[model samples]
Target chain A: MKQNRTMVVIFLTPALLLFFAIFVYPIARTVMMSLFSVENVTSSVSEWTFTGFKNYADLAQTSLFRKSMWNIFRIWAVGGLVVMSLALLFAVILNSGIRFKKFFRAVIYLPNIISAVALATMWLQYVYAPRWGFLTDFFSWLGLEDLAATQWTAAGNKFWALTFAYCFGMVGYHMLIFSSGIEKIPHEFYEASSIDGASKPRQFTNITLPLLKGVVKTNITMWTITSVGFFVWSQLFSTVTTDLDTITPMVYLYLQVFSTGNTVMEREAGLGAAVGVTLGLLVVLVFVLTNLLIREDEIEY
Target chain B: MSTAKREALYRSRQLNWRKEARLLPGYALLILWVIFTTILIGWVAAASLSTTRAIYRGEVFDFAKNGLNFGNYVKGWNSQNVSVFFMNSLGYASVSTVLLVLVAAPAAYVLSRFKFFLNHPIQNGFVVAMGVPVVMIILPLFAVVTQLQLLKQTYTIRLLMVVLYVGINVPYTTIFLLSFFSNLPRSYEEAAAIDGCPPMRTFWKIMLPLAQPGIVTVSIFNFINIWNEYFMSLIFANQDATRPVAVGLYSMINSMKYTGDWAGMFASVMILFMPTFILYLFLSEKIIAGVTGAGVKG
Candidate 1:
């Protein structure tokens, strides 16, 4: 085929130009901005004071920033475990010759399509409501009246509630990934294992787990991306703008750069950039680490 | 009938009681999950049609005692400015999704077809861009947009919003359609070319329409994403008339303390999500396949 350079240029220019404007330029500037002390988000590059690494140092010392970091780390670690296990379990079950697989899969993935704000509202307003909440009603019906009276929105409990809701919404996506991977595995592996009298659980460990190594890495990377961008859930779950219990780094960044929330008094835009840089670094680091750890041993069928 | 489905149907016809019994626990777990999902959305639906008093009184489901009321939707739509929010999102989502396809498809087609030096690098760049968080580039984007003063008026902000939405999703859309275009048999273009059609004409007349299924799938996906987008709109759109539903709903909820219209609030949430929810209802299988197939770049 003859190469049409003009045609390629014409087609690619729009997307390439927009990508540079939207992604490339901003990313480059953000890296620069994180190295400087700036007053506001709208401040010109001319107004920036060169303060190499100080913004990061300030964030490191700042209690709220540290707290937000800790909060997101927990979300990544603990929520990762809960989401992965449930997603894998559901995926295995759904792939195991179930009836109405599409219906169940759709229902599970329903929350992912809806607005996060709306989903969070449902959890905050109804499911976690103290009076007449779903948990309360269920517990009371089961004769656990004292357990039914628990205040889910209280300081101690809000984080778990938030994590639980977030995990529930996320399980569908990871499950679909796992299920696809599971489906791609040769049925003969399972059939032969069963013929050898291996139980289902043993088959899952020996065949399914080993085969899903790439899919597992994909899930973890996707999970990491979502966890790092955990903003809406934290904001919806928080009672205040600066709710220490629920504030992730994203909320912290929003407060520092955009909102006049009480969390940051100085409102240093540089600090926000630093937070972004830290998060971007974390994503890259995790990608690198996952790649290094889960080196794909390609197995051709 | 397909062999797989036929085989499964045949198996299902026979009373595989032992196999069914073995899978009882899986069925129970799936049923429990589906039931929870049903009740979660069901309660919200009931609350949307009930009065605040009924909701607070724990009788939203007691329809006989408290008849279903639709005044909440009316109030939410008319008085709470949800109408503006809904229209903004509808406009933004529809326009951006179309433009996204238009912009992404050509690029994807070219990248998939051509043997250019920049092909792999460009594709890799877009893939990397997918993982780049919004917070990373937001400050500079804000600075540049504000410096250009695009946020001054309602229409400009709306235009800016659409442009931003399209820009954000261009990478994912391109990557998704890249694979779709690659998988397309090149024989279509070759046939058209041999029939005296130019290369570009072949793409427009022959290939683009062939890629319609992928385009529609990704367009729906983009539509839902733009409709539910929050952080960017919250920052950029700043005004009442220009705010999309996600930001609009957030503001409404934030002000619920003073308004105290819990029923109206729930109604607005329904309005926010109903479009995407309805889309999923009719197109879940397509949307799910889109996600698991080539939707989210690994």
Candidate 2:
């Protein structure tokens, strides 16, 4: 038993060390950096002046920060609900003895695999292009030409465009999850329900949904985490727009530090770290809260 | 008695009609959605082949005049040194994925099979790691990489990228493989060990083959992640030569003003997008199975 413990430690050490250095240590550093005022990022002497809660106070006052927080919530609410619902609907349909299921599944999942850059570029040129875009044409066909001519990445439309982009990419994975969950439901139950003259919707509500509770919980958790930490997609879709239009907290923080004209400026590192710490805490808080609210007993299949 | 029988038959027919009516809308909605998604993906393929001029003219459905031009592809491949970027991405993604599988497989095996102290904590730790946002790590990682002089050399930077990849990905890969490893029959490993096979040999020869499907799934996922990664590569590999295709395409798009060649940009995107997209097209079943299967057990 002692030998087994030792072996386990040996196997785990490398991964643990890397995780601490790369993941945990950085978070600690972000907190520490947030407390100081650095003249320059690279060569500044570390004079730690403890400013307890000052950064948080400043964050609250910053409109950009507040706007970003609201945007995050908005995207999660709209995107999360739509994507999960559509995915579940599609999954149920595909699982119902449908022909060409594999082909449809492949078509849906294809977008998820495309590189973010490619996907973003395609959307920008083909769908959201101000002049002569397909989406505009479709809108004209629907007598909504004025709406199509409006800038998609603009603040008014940025949220919806970003949400649509996220949902399009996510539907495939979530659909598969829901489909597998549905597949696990025993056929005997459906047969028995039909024997009892229970309608399809009735069986679905009583049997299928109850059986799929675990999957629903899992999907919700996954989507919540992914949505909260969303960075790349936001960056890709919103970079062309005004910085304030769809600036997520992470991207805003990144721009403050790296993309700003002078890296050696007095304002970069400490402020960037402050933003980072705030974002991290927000993410952790959301994750814990969601889990607590949705916590349920594990259902064994 | 005859009237009672007629009434029962009429009731049965009514029930069947109502059931079929309810099913019609569901099937229609599903079919419509499937067709809509198919048309969109088909548009992507057509756009990849069309000239920028044709696309700008909204000739998506009019493929007869502007169909199947290889000019854009050739230009995309040669222009902006994309071939180098492609090779760099291939090298980085392949190496990183292979290393991740190598490091993660044994760790997953030990975590799954043993009942040692800290076992549950280790698993929980990985779950927490999955929630750690990557943005939080970028600053400190930049400092560490610079301090270690990793940024100066390309090969060292790539190696560190692999290590970073392995570190972040181990959580998911280990968890995924853990379930598969645990599901295998214990008797196979026991028999091999009893037959004078060493422990390592037993795992290598017996357990490894048994876990091939899980390994393949994890590897494919890791490959896609490493290939598609953008932010880390953007930060670490500032040089064009060392940049992967994701960053390469970004810079290409950024430089479009100077080039004024929209066709070139679209072509480059198509080139960068093809390798993974084609793999997805062919192996979608495997990919979906891998992801869904992992989710179920997890």
Candidate 3:
């Protein structure tokens, strides 16, 4: 399969050139853009005023940015907790030799194939609609009048409601990942345990969970990345361009760059770039930490 | 066999009432979740065929009374421009998938099969690129596109979106196909070499066809992604003529607030999802494999 130098160059040039033009260049430009105070991201560089760390300092001072940081952290931490547990539970149940497993798996994974914009809109108008919405009806039927009375889309509860819907769409995708990981474990392990007269719960704890450590780590890393990219659902949930209730770092970055409505007094592409830099660093940080902590080499399974 | 052995065998089979009962809770939970997941999409389908008043009044499932109102589809397609967006998405997704495969497959072949100086770093770069969020580069990328004067030029913007789609997907597609090419046996190439074929010819005539399944899987993944991509198109192809289904549907929903044609909006949503639904119906296995395979191995 070995090829000579000329063939290698011919084969690799297209992808390398594309990688540089689209990804490497933009990322490099983003980092550099963050260091300069530019009027418009599209403006010429001669008009740029060099600002060293001032954008980052301004971001530190901005309360909305602080709120956005907190919001994204919650999404990563809180939403991560919910999605991981639910996806794992579903994966385990389905992998435990259930009937109609394929049907259930497909139904659960259906949302993942649909556009986020469509899913978010469906959640907003159908499930979270003020009056005869599914949640309101269900809660009222359960006789939890107080819960039914609360507006799910209101400023206070919109974040949690958005998180729940997002997690609902996401769980199936992660569940499929877990299913594949669980499927890889040889059936003999379970059979041997059962023959040894071990309880099902005991077998799951001792064998299934340990074997799935790598999958769990993968799921966590993925959850972190998706939460960091949370934008569409936030935009769909909020009526305004930049609502504090659902503003993630992505939305904040968008508002800064686009400067729509009364949100941004001036176009601060530098601050927007700074936000990008921060989020980018956060992803790299999580990735490195996960790799260090997970220690894939330590587990044979 | 003794009665004790028979009893042990019966116990191991998990056919007893108590063992079956143990699975009941799990089944119940799964059934509840499945119902919850399907109901929203199902209701949307029904709503798309009902009157807007019926939907507003929560009679979406009351088909016996409200019956089917087919005008919503006509309205969405013609008046609301759903057809334009649908065609735009189909074109973008198809072209992008082809471009992605064409660009990524050869690089993957080289990276997986050849001994190159920057092989490790190149592969590592793609892996790292996957972890970085798109929002990181998007703002600056927007700047670049604007600087290129592609804004408001519908065809050029559409082309920009296609190029961006291919670029964003190149890393994952390469990595996905890399594993496929690596797992391929070396004998295929050796045979082609012995037959007096050049390496590029061998790749084009032999290896490429052999890797059809992997290429198909990667292409389907790209197609679905580019079709469903929102943020990028919302920025790049915001023009009426160039908007894809995702952005088009978003703006349609926003306008529907004033128009009050809720059923038409739902119809647009149906139009938006129909292609993917049809794809999923026929190619569920491929979609699932492409999605979960990329996640698991990568």
Candidate 4:
């Protein structure tokens, strides 16, 4: 349909304007801000000193930043592996003509609908709390006294506990994605394989795994994005603003830009911007790398 | 029976038998997962109805002895400001979803249907923007909002958050609707044109109604997102009067340290979770479709 220029502009104006204001301007400002040292994000540009790459170099030298970088990498890699495999397994099961498919899918995906704050609080106070926590009580009831006595929320175990909770909350979401992908695979492929007398495991290896490569890529990209933006859960699990055990890059960025009083190390907007930029780049890199590495031509059903 | 038919029936029956026997392991694992997830949420529900004393005594599932206390809900709602936070969350999410659909639909239609010179670039811009996480833009956005003095005024800050919600969601919403618009048959628009309707009028009067399922799906997704959105709201709408349920609930948990109102805290979580939980119970298909569609299609 040929459209008038005025009508075209009218149709597009609100979206374009909002996009520029909310996304484009802020992102551009962030890039510029990262090159200069500013005390706080709200400071005037005139107060910014040209710090060049000092902020990035400083970040490299800072042990906390290094620790956070390692923490995020572990979350992305370790959590990605666990969530993806479980999601795939569940998706495969649900697609195998199982009973209660709807009930099971909903149960798995229930955590995705709840607010992150509430889920994290539930995990913190209910599941991991030393006193009367679910794990402690369950293990003790199971007669595993040594396991029951373990302090899940203590600094030694807090990071893993946080990752475990985060992974639990995420599995349902990724499972849904995998289930949808599996649903699209025609039953004929499985039927033919079964007719050929291939074992169930063999059929999965031959048909299911290859077919799910694309969905796996999507899951990995999504996991990368979430892993990089990890914040609220970290805050809930950490004792202080700058806890080394639970802090991710996003938490570090928040502290650098916004923390005040005793929580404040120093308000360094430039460094925070650098952190944001690095995190953004890390996500993009993963996306591109995953795409490159997993270049299997998707089979169109 | 004919020999060929008898053999075919036997083969099919054998296949069914093998499938059933092989699925036992899968069933076991799935049941374990279902029980684990369900019990966690169920335990929370039970605790929300019990007193803090019973909860401390590890009587979470012991309803008869603990005596279900409905007062926790009343106290949480009235005394703890959950009602206020719930209302704020509802208002923001609904308004943002409406505004998002309003702005995104027309743009998506134009981008998908018409061939403007800049169409491809604009489309790619949105797709690229999807990869840019909110954390990247947030600090600068906060700075800008603060400089405008929007932080001091509750209403303006709320409005700003709605705007932010709409803006951040536009890329996904538009891209989502783009596929819907493109997949739609052009016959309706052609018929509308023959009947003397203008293009803009056609979009509003005819095209939109045809895409109702997609519109509803995307809007539900937007509603769930903005309702649970914490990070941006924590910065922009941090005031007690304006905080959404996500931030509100976080602060409530922190305050439990002083008050020791653990039951009230659980009740507050239930209140915060109730809307999305109910929505999920009723419209799970839409939620699943909206979420997975974004991932697989992209």
Candidate 5:
């Protein structure tokens, strides 16, 4: 028993130390930094003037910051709904005894494995580009030439375009989740439903869906948290239509800190920390809310 | 009477055919969606292979006029720093995966096998950490890295990345392996203990081999997540020689105004996806199992 305690300490120390250094300490510093105002580009004085709640106050008043907060909700609402619906649909189709099930699954999942940058680029060049992209040409060939010329990633269409892109990239992964959930359902359930003269639609609505509640909850939680934490993809693609400052809150903060060329200014640091903390709190709130809504229940197969 | 009965049976068969016909529209919609997806993917592949002139001419579908060539691939490979980018990704992902498994396996074993004062709280903490945003952690990490002067060298940055990856990944890996380890029958270990084999020896020889599937699943996940990670790599390793393919591709795209090499950019994107695509083709079952299996069970 003594040896076991020693073993636990030995095993856990490295991970705990690294976590404290990388995860815990940095968060503490961010909160502290958010309380100060920048004095210079390189360094700040130890004479810390604690501006109580001013940073948060400033953030609330900024239009760009407010728009970013709204944009986060818009993206999550539209993108999350579409992705989940498509995932459920595909899961049902794939779960139905289809030919080439594995091939279909692989094709659907291909986008998930590709890097986010690559996936975004592929969408921009092939599907959403206005002039020479395939979708444009296809529409033009169908005599909707003007519609074909509509810029997809332009400011006018950016929100829908971004949402679709997010959904398309995410559907395969969530579909795979739902499909596995469906696979676990016993064949007897379907057989009994059919014996009782229940139609396919009825069976799906009643048995398949309720059985999949757990998987759905998991996917929703994942999507919500990840969407709130989103920085890279939004920055990569939306920057085309949106201002560098008008992207997601996280990207907005990132640009403030890192986009300065060569001159390390500390002014943006405090503001950036303020933005980061706000975004973090928002994400945590969403996670907690979602967790509360998604109550745990065991489904017997 | 016999002729009438035969006619009635044939009528019932006709009604059944009509019932099956009602399912056709759903199937048709699925097929149509698949076709659309295929066209999009094919167009991207063709764009990657075409010359800039062909692309400008809007002859994307005219494969006969614009045959495939490796020129774009060569240009992309050279211009995008694909060589260095690929190496950096490989090193970071491989090193992180190895260390994650090494730390997580033993930790998971102890948590599952032994009862401790803080076991439940530790488990809960890991679950909570899973939801913590990477953005929340990045600011602090950036501050820490700068203070440590670890950002000055590529090797040091990579080492820090490995440690960070392992640290964050611990919660998931430990929880994952915990279930597997605990599901293991305790009788085997008890017998080994009675036979005078030390606990460590039993773990190395008996439990490790038994928990191979869980280890493989978790390791694969760690590998994929690290490989696909863009944000951390973007901030920490933005320098050209150390950038991973994801960040490298982004920089290449961002430089298009200066370079005007869209074909080269697309080609590199295709190349960057190759490893992941191939892995998906071969081991999709495992990937699916790892993701959905882990989530549902947890």
Candidate 6:
């Protein structure tokens, strides 16, 4: 048997071409574009004027940019905690000899399939509707008039509401990951531990958590990537363009470059590129950090 | 029938009381979650079928008075240009899904079979590209397209959207199929080669049909993704005539909110999601199996 060079080359050319055009070339250009001032997004290569790190400096000084940064950090940290714990809990429960497993899993994962726009609208328009909202209805039914009357999509609770809704949609995907991870661990470990008089919680801590180290890393990295690209939920959540409560970095970037009436005067194209690079850096940084943190050896089954 | 029922009728005889008691908390939590989920989407479904006036009056579920308003769907489909968005998405998603398989399957098969010098590097690059946020690559792609004046014309913009959709997914599709192709027994290829069948023909005739199950599962995932994709479509197809349902529905919802046509708004929400919703209804089991079994981490 021989390696067919011509066949390999012929087969791989189309994929390789797409990869270079889409991922390789664009990423390289974006990183370079971030360092310079471009006349416009459509500006040709010759129009780019070098202004090293000025875009970064400008972003640091801009308060809206700063606020967007703060908002996304909260979303990542707080929302991450909520989604991970809930996903883990649901996964554990589903794997615990429960009936209706298939039905529960499918229904729980339902929100992920729907467009985020539609899902967010269901939250903002109905769940958070001041007049006949789900929250108001439920609370009023329980005889808590004050809680029912409280506005949910209003500024005070709007950010947390956005976070909550986003977390709700995200849990199912991560739950599937954790569920599959739990299923991979042989039942014999639990059986032996139980025979030795270990409690369920003890078995979980001693066996499941350590065994799931790689999955935890995968989930964290994925969570960070999705968090960085957060846009549609925040966009649909806010009425005004610059709603301070829910403005994420992606939304800010869109407003800066893609939308009209942007406040930044010099070159929003550069600023947008800078924002992208900053986000790309965040993903890489977190990936590196999580790898260092979750350094358990992969145990073979 | 009565004896059969009576034989297993005793609650005490049929039940595992202590185990059931132990799992009671799990059931309670899950049931509460399920109930909440039901109320959330269920209310939205009900609201879509009632008039805005009834919705505001909190009479959506009071069907005895205000019966289902099927007219809301008509308004959503016709007046709002949802029909255009939906058709555009259907075109973009279906076309790109096919091209993704066509472009990716060959590369996947080659990489999985042949040990070329760049094979490992290419594989690693694609896996990393899967994790690369769209933000990183979008600006350059946008710039080049804008400079090329591709976004100006309707046809070119449509072509651009399809191309982008296919390109963005090429890595994922290729990587997914790589594992699928690798797992296939190589004896078929050997038998074909021994029979003097060329490598290329073998791939097309034998190996491809063999990989149909994997291709179908991954295609289902891809179809749902492209159908529901928002950010790229929002940027590229921002115009009234070209936008996908997700973005189209956003602008429609804004206007409808002002018009106070709440029923129409919810109805459009249904229109936006119905394709993928119906898709999942049939294939939820297959889709879930893919997610759990594979190393797909999107």
TM-score (0 to 1) of chain B for each candidate: 0.95, 0.87, 0.91, 0.93, 0.87, 0.92
Q: Candidate 3 docking category? A: medium
lDDT of all the models against the reference?
Answer: 0.91, 0.75, 0.86, 0.87, 0.75, 0.90
* Residue lDDT tens for model 4, B53-144: 99899887888888888899998788767788889999999999999999999999999888789999999999888878877899889888
* Top-TM-score candidate index: 1
lDDT per residue as tens, model 6, A36-109:
99868878888899999999999999898899999999999999999999999999999998888999999888
All candidates: CA RMSD (Å): 1.9, 5.2, 3.2, 2.8, 5.2, 3.4
Q: What is candidate 1's lDDT per residue for B1-298, written digit by digit as tens?
A: 9999999999888878888898899999999999999999999999999988998899898988888888888887887678888999999999999999989999999999999799999999999999999989999999999999999999899999988999999999999999999999988887887899989888888889999999989999999989989889989999999998899889798787457888888888888878999999999988998888775533
DockQ, all models: 0.76, 0.42, 0.64, 0.68, 0.44, 0.68
| lDDT per residue (tens digit) for residues A1-301 in model 5 | 7766787888777656655665677677677777776432123336446786777787787776677778777878888888899888888887776556777777777778778888877777668876677668788899997878888888778767776877888988888888888998899999999999999899999898878767776787678777876676787675643453337777667666766553432345667778777767776676577668766566654
What is the per-residue lDDT of model 3 for residues A99-184, given as tens digits with 9 covering 90 to 100? 77888888888899898988888898889877757888789999999988889999889999998889889998899888888898
Between the candidate structures 3 and 4, which one is better when assessed by lDDT? 4
Question: Candidate 3: where are CA atoms >4 Å away?
Answer: A1-3, A261-263, A297-301, B1-19
TM-score of chain A of 5: 0.86
Q: Which residue pairs show backbone clashes in model 6?
A: none
**If both were scored by TM-score, which would come out higher, candidate 2 or candidate 4?**
4
User: What is the two-chain DockQ of model 4?
Assistant: 0.68
Number of backbone clashes in candidate 5: 1
Predicted candidate 1 versus true structure: per-residue lDDT over A94-138, tens digit per residue: 999887898999999999998999999998888998876999999
lDDT by residue (A1-301, candidate 4, tens digit) is: 3466777899899999998998899999898888999988899889999989988998998888899999999888898889998988999999988777988888889999899988998888888878878899999999999999999989899999999999999999899988988888899999998899998889999998888878888888888888888998999998977898998998888777776664546668899899988898898899899899988774666
Grade the docking of candidate 4.
Answer: medium
Models 1 onward score TM values of: 0.97, 0.89, 0.94, 0.95, 0.89, 0.96
TM-score of candidate 6 relative to the true fold: 0.96
The DockQ leader among the candidates is 1
List, residue by residue over B141-225, the lDDT tens digit for candidate 2.
7766777889888788777777877777888887888888999999997898689776666777888889998898878878887
Show the lowest summed lDDT stretch of 10 residues, model 1 chain A.
A258-267
Which segments of model 2 are wrong by more than 4 Å? A1-10, A38-47, A141-151, A239-242, A262-268, A295-301, B1-23, B60-64, B257-260, B295-298
